[model samples]
Target: MIENIHFIAVALLIALGIYTLIFKRNLIKIAMGISILASGINLFLISLGYRAQGIAPIFTNAAIAASEVQAKMVLPAPQALTLTSIVISLAVTALMLSFAIIIYQKTGSLDATKSRRLKG
Candidate 1:
């Protein structure tokens, strides 16, 4: 279980985010929850690339012994993907907050329930 702690953390983060999204009634809280969810997903993606006793994928370093080559190599894909996800989530969070600010400005309310413009 110790080896899989990252997975446990990922699940906990995701659950916390979902809980916040569901129970919170403020737009800011919703945006924060979304950001948390994104972070959880990013962590999960990064954890997927973790290798036991693995070396970075740098092959030009002669300092590493040949025997070390037998060890697993951590792929760059997951890191790159996590980076991309972080950027995208940042942009999305900023956009969501901006909209929330605008709504508060126009409607004078931050409550998600009260900010609704449609009624059926």
Candidate 2:
């Protein structure tokens, strides 16, 4: 029962992001939606690799052996991927925000309709 909450939250983030992307015309809001959507995907990846009461794969003490870790430790791949995704998301969000700033400067409005009119 408790484990389902993570998945539910992930769904909510993605749905809300899509809603914002579709309904909102503001450039900043759309960028935010993209960020939220990326976060949802990262969460989904993490949930896929989750294990109940699982420990790290690393061996800290001298007594622990590799065989024990193989059976009980959670996979580390998802965590590493999540970290990489976070860095990529940050860069993309920064780029999007910079573009939004440029658009706002040229059109004096963040609305998609105004930007489209300015383009043609």
Model-by-model lDDT, in order? 0.92, 0.90
The root-mean-square deviation over C-alpha atoms between each candidate and the true structure, in angstroms, is: 1.6, 2.0
lDDT of 1 by residue, 1-120 (tens): 999999999999999999999999999999999999999999999999988878888888645787776566678899999999999999999999999999999999999898777889
lDDT of 2 by residue, 1-120 (tens): 776999998999999999999999999999999999999999999998898878877667724567777667889999999999999999999999999999888879999866786453
Q: How far is candidate 1 from the true structure (C-alpha RMSD, Å)?
A: 1.6
Q: Give stretches of model 2 more than 4 Å off.
A: 60-65, 118-120
Q: How much is 53 displaced in model 1, in angstroms? A: 2.1
Structural similarity to truth (TM-score) of each candidate: 0.91, 0.89
| Residue pairs in clash, model 2 | none
**For candidate 2, what is the lDDT?**
0.90
